[model samples]
Target chain A: MSAFTRFTPLIQSLPSTIPFVGPEAIERQRGRAIAARIGANESGFGPAESVVQAMREAATGTWKYADPENHDLKQALATRLGVSAANIAIGEGIDGLLGQIVRLVIEPGMPVVTSFGAYPTFNYHVVGHGGRLVTVPYVGDREDLDGLLAAVKKENAPLVYFANPDNPMGSWWPAERIVEFAKALPETTLFILDEAYCETAPAEALPAIDAFIDMPNVVRTRTFSKAYGLAGSRVGYVVTTPGTAQAFDKIRNHFGMNRIGVAAAVAALADRDYLATVTARIAHSRERIAEIAQSNGLSPLVSATNFVAIDCGRDAVYARAIVDTLMSDHGIFIRMPGVAPLNRCIRVSTGPQAEMDLLEAALPNVLAKLAGGQ
Target chain B: MSAFTRFTPLIQSLPSTIPFVGPEAIERQRGRAIAARIGANESGFGPAESVVQAMREAATGTWKYADPENHDLKQALATRLGVSAANIAIGEGIDGLLGQIVRLVIEPGMPVVTSFGAYPTFNYHVVGHGGRLVTVPYVGDREDLDGLLAAVKKENAPLVYFANPDNPMGSWWPAERIVEFAKALPETTLFILDEAYCETAPAEALPAIDAFIDMPNVVRTRTFSKAYGLAGSRVGYVVTTPGTAQAFDKIRNHFGMNRIGVAAAVAALADRDYLATVTARIAHSRERIAEIAQSNGLSPLVSATNFVAIDCGRDAVYARAIVDTLMSDHGIFIRMPGVAPLNRCIRVSTGPQAEMDLLEAALPNVLAKLAGGQ
Candidate 1:
């Protein structure tokens, strides 16, 4: 148990904890394989066939380091988004970019604001940089934009995070409200407008790419993980002002990108037809999930994301029992939000029909077992 | 030219710069294609067939995130190295791991010790974390171990970096000397014994894996990017005490690993015969490069790495001219060290026969042109 004793005080004060325990860890810990792999919001539909082919082709060149400037991918993204390549910055994923953003802005003891039960990974980064957390509560299972702005102004926080088509709860605010919130924030406050679930959301739920393209204080993060269905590829980017995007070059691991992953993302972007088809399939799957939840007498919240949150009409204890029992007894894996009120709901990601079929059959029996005190 | 107004003072003070200009950027800037890529120490020999096949196979699972715990890869590495899984931590690459290591121990103004002309990426990380650098000059081309020890003791520095079979100069000390240096350091000073080229080094040049396994202050970093010929795979690991290894889990992006890249590393490790073949090829290429340099009236240093550093019999100006003319006139891409003494040499990475043939044909012509004052 001997450790190097000279770690920075901030790093020493932090716990060695994962923001979310991945499903693989659960399988290992429980000695059971996940039958319905819908806990994480990864698209079970997978990436386009062309993307797989592109990755396979790129594999032959695996000995070459990826372009440190990320030229090709940035060019592709810019062409598609109606922006210049200088306005885009790529990273390992949105998670990695979030860490970089925190480092770029937060000094020790600086205040960062986010929803109480928002993405834990963001909170993890904020704390890693010795930033003080100033959390607002989720209002109506959606991130409270006005509350977040109020907290930011009160603390004079340098950073604020708000995810559209949010995770865990799968709720979202319309584009107009989000744009209003962005414009209302103080110019000094940097806003991370995460659009990780935008591809699966209603058109009205996402602002236009040009909505804040000139706004230096706003950075919108997008990912290839959800609708593009390449979660394992680890490609994500930030859409911000050119100068803001360039700031990342100061500290990012210049050659850290995986070559095949970049190729996968580029291929995924090129296949617009595939994206349209997959988003439709995702929508269909979400409907199926909602139907199953309703049939089991659970109230499924309206979600714009790739998942649905079903209210169990009980406390966190009951929700915890359902999550654990489903995983342990039936090999089903689903997750719930981490805090009060939100934890009253269990989140299930949309997946292919086979996984949906498994969830359909297991939920009623799990409810019965719980009702009968197991 | 707009950016967020309230970035940290440290971030504001730092310039946006990349440590190394990638060949791709050079190609873009020069408006030419590189006919021979022997720069950046990337293995143009490429990865093994088995590794490529594994990556192609893993491409289908690109929709699922890599296991955050990295269980399979960790198990494979531990089994190969005869250490427990807890004694290792994986990252995007050695570059990424160096950044994490810097963040772990360094606060603003903390002194960090390294060679004067060592890896620029390591220096970038230290500077990015606001650590004050204390550099010891190289002795004869090899890193000066005693001088580094002196600096660490003089500054009471918490961190020191020394790479074996060093980059740019490609020089190394005997394993016994390295171990002696490690033992001589104050226990309070963390030693980063970077064994990036160990696979290609002579048996006497590398200490046994268990040499510093019990030492809490020593962390040895190894990469598949070198001998395994998988630079684009972005898989590197740290061999350290279990406690120190666990510290990475505190700040690392848990799910940052690319699925196909990890698959390639696992496959690369499993195929020991291919590793042997590639390392042999690398060694052969190095000899061919040395011959080319000698025939061109240059002094090629004995190299343990995949690259040879050839003394141009002049100053940095001559080395810089040779590098620039090789690329601009012959489309041959190579690099030189960044500082004095080391900058008298131009570094060439070992590659396949084709690239060596290009270098063989071009170096004399470029030298002739330089002699003619072109």
Candidate 2:
């Protein structure tokens, strides 16, 4: 059957896709369960006991729509960030918030700037909204903040996206450089500073929350998905000037939040000791992944996030084969970048010791097989 | 601080608004704890014990993102609906789906049609997307099927909304007329056949699942929120042709579904006995609400939903006073319609006996005060 013949030209032009194939989809396609899931940058250490308890407690009350105002969660976030509740806007995840931000800023054919190999979900949203993308390549595996600002000016772009402790490459720019980039951008250009992995990054790598508190042009997005290990709960929030934050209220699906997720996130925020313990484990896992890579004669990139991007010492084709071989032959799930040069590396998320052991054992075998075949 | 200088003109034109204030907001504003929660059409009876069990079970696995394909939930929903999984598109809720649907078909200035006060959230979405709402007023408190079709033809509108077992007034039309309305619409005029209250409505009031299955232009939206009692779970779906259903995947937040919510919805669908039990309770509560309205000399509209619209024999001011007085004097929460004539009635959701008893006790006293006042 044909689709309704009248979908706006832009929607009709788009395709159903995701930035990365989920592990569940891989398991289904390969007809095998994933023995080790170290992909998608999800923290496999799991949420704090308090968060699980909160989710379990909130489960029975799943008949009431979450408050449209998201009063409690926003207040909790605001208190933690030392900002007022009006300065935060909560969303399903950074992915959902990206879509809303695109809708707010980009009309058809409007230019948006971002690194060519940055978060694909942000690009998906911009294209879904018919925004024209102006791509800038990464510099030294990190987002080119200078190039991004220059492109924003050249195109008179209204929006730019920069992820700190970035995805795929697992690289970061220092907080001072980030703040400088934000200050250098034209006032009319709104910058989405995605800090999804902020908790796992080093102290100096993150700006103080107050650094851009007065700039309506900046929205720093964060999520409980990484350090808090609540990816499936879909809780993410943004901090911006109160005026810009309120703009989300004008068009957001006001009652869209899942109640238990909100409860989980609130509980996760309160469990500081759990967060500290998990980050230490993540740091250990990152070291283990790098060790595995170096032992296999691969170059592991220095990472500030919860993942290690190891250069496979070959082209995209070789990296692709190793990724497929790991999952198909070993039941291990990992990912790679979509763009060339970056695609020469494979990205593995930090996880529990058992999964690390599985990855540690699987990597050498997959590498040996690939080298023999080549 | 002001918002950034250049949100798309359309976004800048819109105001931050909520369709209806939530009961939580009411509690916060009035500094009164709600003793009886019957507002906003939530099932105060709550979700099934089985669904709650499922959500609790799913809570620990909150570290992994939900399957973007939503494979299990879609398969289960498809089996129950006797439709292919391809024919269904899952979303956060009907409210979220409405936002997606609007974005799919609407560009700035495009005309969409629905009753003036049918569902404020739907109107909010249309206006949010820059779609011009061509509203047709309700005829005799029920959506005028003929009028909606006429508006679609006159405006050449690409989208129209009609809710069976409608909100606010709790009115409905028979299946035959609804089917006829669907078949008579211009094929290009996509109709949103909102069946939110289908389970609570009389059997004859709803068209069969297959009634408009072949028509690509008719998309039926149903929610676990209304009948299955998973409102906070945020699970809703659309039944349409596979092609149109797939259109949602192109623009939706692919990994946005909360894992526990999906599990809860799937469990809710399987608990048939619980659904039957709750529907009966809803019917009983509806009658009790009518009794309370009649005993107080108010006229209760014939309801096909889990709510009753009681005409208090006055203008919006008197209805508003009753709503306010109920909250302030007795902490009984309820709502009224937004538009004139319909605003003369207050709406109450069906719930457990304790809440019904509270409403039963409070209404007469509130009414007496209103009548005695100037």
Candidate 3:
């Protein structure tokens, strides 16, 4: 149990933790294989066939380091987004970019504002860097923009995080409201407008690329992991002013990207037809999830993401029981929010029909078992 | 040029910079393609055919996020090293792990000790986290362990970095001396024993795993990027006390690893026979590089790495001229250290005879042109 005694006080104070226990960990612990892999918001539809081919082709170049400047990928993204390459900074994933953003702005004891039950990984980074968290409660199931703004102003917080088409709850505000919230924030505050699930959201839910392109304080993080169906590719980027985007170079691991992953991401981005097909499939799966939840007498929250949050109509205990039972008994892995109210809903990611079929079969029995326990 | 006005004072004080300019950047700036990419110390010999096949096979699973715990890879490493899984922590690469280790022990303005011009990327991370650097100059082209020990004590620095069979210089200490150096450091000081080139080093240059296994303050980093020839795969790990190893879980992007990259690494580890063959090839290439430098009247330093650093027998200007002329005129990419003393040498990575033939043909002309310039 001996540890290096001289770790920074902040690092020492933080707990050794993970934002979510992966399905692999659960399978190892329970001695069972997962039948339905829909817990972590990954697209079960997989990447385009062309992406796999690109990755395989790139594999031969595995002995060379990835381009430290990320030139080609940036140029490709800029062309796709109709922005200059200088306005984009790529990293391993949105999760990795979030960590870098936290490091850039959060000094010891600086205030960072976000929702109470927001992405735990962001909170973990904020705390690891000694930033004080100022939490705003979710108003209903959606992140409360007003509450977040109020907290930011009150604390004069330097940074804030807001995810559109949010995780865990699968709720979102429309484009205008989101733009309004970004514009209303103080110019001193750096707003991380995470659009991780934007591809799965209704078109009306997303703001135009130019809407906040000129706003230096607003950084929109997007990823190929979700709708592009290359979760394991580890490609994500931030759209911001050139100056703000350049700041990432000061601290990011310059040669840290995997070359094959970048190739896969580039190919995935080029395959627009495949993306459209996947989006349609995800929408259908979301509808199927809602139908299954409703049939089981659970209320499914209206969703803008590739997932649904079904209210079990009880407390966190009941929700917890259902989540555990589904995985343990049926090998159907799903998750719930970490805090109350939100914890009453279990989150399930949209997947292919086979996974959807597994979920359909498991939910009824899980509910029955949980009800029997109660 | 607009940016968030309220970034932390440390971030505001830091400049946006990249430690190394990628070959791609140089090519773009010069409007030329790299004909011989014997720069950045990357293995142009490429990864094993088996490893490449493994990556191709893993490409289809790019939809699934790599296991957060990295169980399979950890198990493979542990079994290979005759250690427990708890002794290992996996990361994107040694570069990524170095950043994490610096973050673990360094707070703003805290003293960090390393050999001057040892590793620029490590220095970049230390500065990014606001740590003050205390550098000891390299003695006789090998890191002066005694001088480093003195600086660590003088500053009471909590972190010290030492790379055996070091980069840029390709020099190393005997295994006994390295072990002695690790044992000599204050228990409060964390020693980063970087062994990124261990596979290329003679057995006498590396301590047995058990030598420092019980020391909570010692962390040994290894990478598949070197001898395994999987630099783009971006797989690296730290071997340390279980407690010290667990600290990474607190702050690492748990799901950051690319699936195919991990698969390549595990496969690379399993094929030791391929590694042995690659190691011999690298040694042969290194000798050829040294001979090439000698034939050009440059003094090639003795190398224990995949690259050779040749003394240009003048100053930084001469070294820089040779590097620039080689690239611009011959499309041969190579590099040199940034600081004085070391900058008198141009470093070249080992590659196939074709690249060596390019160097062998180009170096004489480039040297003659540099002599004419003077």
Candidate 4:
């Protein structure tokens, strides 16, 4: 139980708690293999064959460290997004970038703002840097933008986070409203506009790529993890003003990138047809998930992302029971929101038909078992 | 030029600088492709075929996020090292882990100790955290372990870094001396024993795997990047007491690991025969490099690493000329130590015979051109 006695006071004060328990941990704990891995919202549709080919080819070159500047990847991303490579900063994932962003803006006791029950990992980074979080409750199962702005102003917080096509709730605000929210924020407040789910989100749900290009206060994060189906590859980037992008260089591990992962990401960006096909498949799968929820007398929330959050028409306990029973009884893995109101819904990721089939067959029995108090 | 104006004073004050200019950047700057990629200390001998196959297999599963706990990889490393899974923490690489370690121990203005010519990435992390560096100079081309201990004691530095079978110099201290050094450090001073080159070192050069397991203040860093030829995979781990090991979870990006990279590491570990073969090849390549240096009228230091540091028998200017001419005139990319004394030597990574041949054929001419002052 011994530990180094001289860790910083902020580090000492923090708990060694993880933001989320992964599906793999759940498998180990339950002593059962998951039949449907829909919980984490990863695309079971998978990446393009071309991307797989690229990753396989890149494997032979694994002896060399990846380019520290990530020049090629940046050029590819910049070209695709219609932004300059100078405006982009790449990291292991959006999660990693979030940690860096938090470190850049926050010092001990600094106030930060985010929606209650939004991304817990963001909260983890905030607290890790000794930043005090001022959370605004989600309204209508969507992140409360106005509330977040109000809290930021009242607390004079330096940082705020908002995820579009948000997790757990499968809800979103329109692009115009989001743009309005960014414009309304004080220039001193750094806004983290997380667009991890933008690939699958409706076109109207996302702002033009350049909408915040001139706003130094805005940092939009995008990732290859969702519709691109490279979650395990762990490639993500930030789009910000050139100066803000350069700030990351001051703190980032220059050679931290995985070569094969970067190759997969580059290849993923090139295969536009695959992206279109995957998004269509993801949309279809979402429909299937919604149908399964409705057949079991549940209401599925409207979704722009690659997942459906079904309202169980009950409390957190009921939703938790369903989530647990679905995994325990049928080896179907799905998640639920961590906080109330949203916790009444069990979130299901869009996957191929096989996972939807497992969900379709398991939900009724799970609900019936819960109703019968067993 | 716009940036978020509210960055913490420490971050704002720091200039954006990278620790090393990657060879890829050199290619871009010079507008030429490198023929010999023996810089950055990466293995051009490449990872085992088994590892490549494993990475290819894992590529399809890129749709799923890597396990946040990294349970399987930890179990594999623990079983191989005869340690418990709780005793290890995995990171993107030693560089990423160094950043985390610095964050854990250093606050603004705190002193941090390391050899002056040691890993620049470690120094980069300290500076990024606003830690004041208290550097001990290398004595006789080896890290000044005694000097490091004295500095740490004098400054009451909470963190100290020492790389055995060191980078940039390719020098090492034997097992007993390293153990003695560890035992002499104050309990409050966290010692980072970087063994990034251990796989290529002689057996007597490494302390027993369990030698410092009970010492909470000691965290031994290791990587798959060296002899395993998986530098681009970005997998590294720290072996330490369970309490200290768990501390990484408090601030790390939980899903930060690349799934394919982890698979490659596990496969690399399982293929013990390949590791032995690659290490032998690395040793042979190092010998070949030494012979080449000797033939070119330069003195190569005795090495226990995948690279050899060759003394150019002059100042840093001459050494710089040799490195630059090799790259510019002959497409031979190599590097040198960043600081004086060590900077008198040019560092060359061990690679395939083709690269060695390229170096052998090019070195004399590059030296001749430098001697001619053109």
Candidate 4 or 1, higher DockQ? 4
TM-score (C-alpha, index-matched) for candidate 3:
0.99
lDDT of 1 at A344: 95
In model 4 chain B, the worst 10-residue window by lDDT is: B365-374
Model 4 Cα shift for residue A307 (angstroms): 0.7
Q: Residue by residue across A1-374, what tens digits does model 4's lDDT show?
A: 88888888888899999888899999999999999999998999999999999998898989889999999999999999999999999998999999999999998899999998889899899999999989899998899988998999999999999899888788999999999999999999999999999999999999999999999999999999999999998899999999999999999988999999999999999999999999999999999988899988999999988899999998999999999999999999989889987899999999999989889999999999888995
TM-score on B-chain, cand. 1: 0.99
Q: RMSD to native for every prediction?
A: 0.9, 0.9, 1.1, 0.9
Instruction: Give candidate 1 misplaced runs (Cα > 4 Å).
Output: none
Instruction: Rate residue B55 of model 2 by lDDT.
Output: 90
Where in model 4 is the C-alpha error above 4 Å?
Answer: none
DockQ of each: 0.90, 0.85, 0.88, 0.92
The residue-by-residue lDDT of candidate 3 on B1-374, one tens digit each, is: 87777777888888888889999899999999999999988898889899999999999888989999999999999999988899999999999999999999988889999988899999999999889999999999989999999999999999999899898799999999999998899999999999999999999999998999999999999999988889998999999999999999989999999999999999998998999998999999999998888887889999999999999899998889889999999999999988889999999999988999999999889988877877
Every model's TM-score: 0.99, 0.99, 0.99, 0.99
Candidate 3 deviant stretches above 4 angstroms:
none
DockQ comparison, 2 vs 4, better candidate: 4
Q: Which 10-residue window of candidate 2 chain B scores lowest in summed lDDT?
A: B16-25
Residue-pair clashes per candidate = 0, 0, 0, 0
* B1-374 per-residue lDDT for model 1 (tens digits): 99888888888878899999999999999999999989989999899999989999999998999999999999999999999999999999999999999999999899999999999999999999999999999889989988998899999999999899788799999999999999998888899999899899998899988999999999999999988889998999999999999999999999999999999999999999988998899999989999999998999999999999999999999899999999999899999999989999999999999999999999999999899994
The DockQ of predicted model 2 stands at 0.85
Q: How well is each residue in A50-136 modelled by candidate 3, as lDDT tens digits?
A: 888999999999888899888889989999989999899999999999999999898889999999898998898898788999999
For model 3, state the Cα shift of residue A188 in Å.
1.2
Candidate 2, residues B182-238: lDDT per residue as tens digits?
999988989999999999999999998899888889899999998788889899999
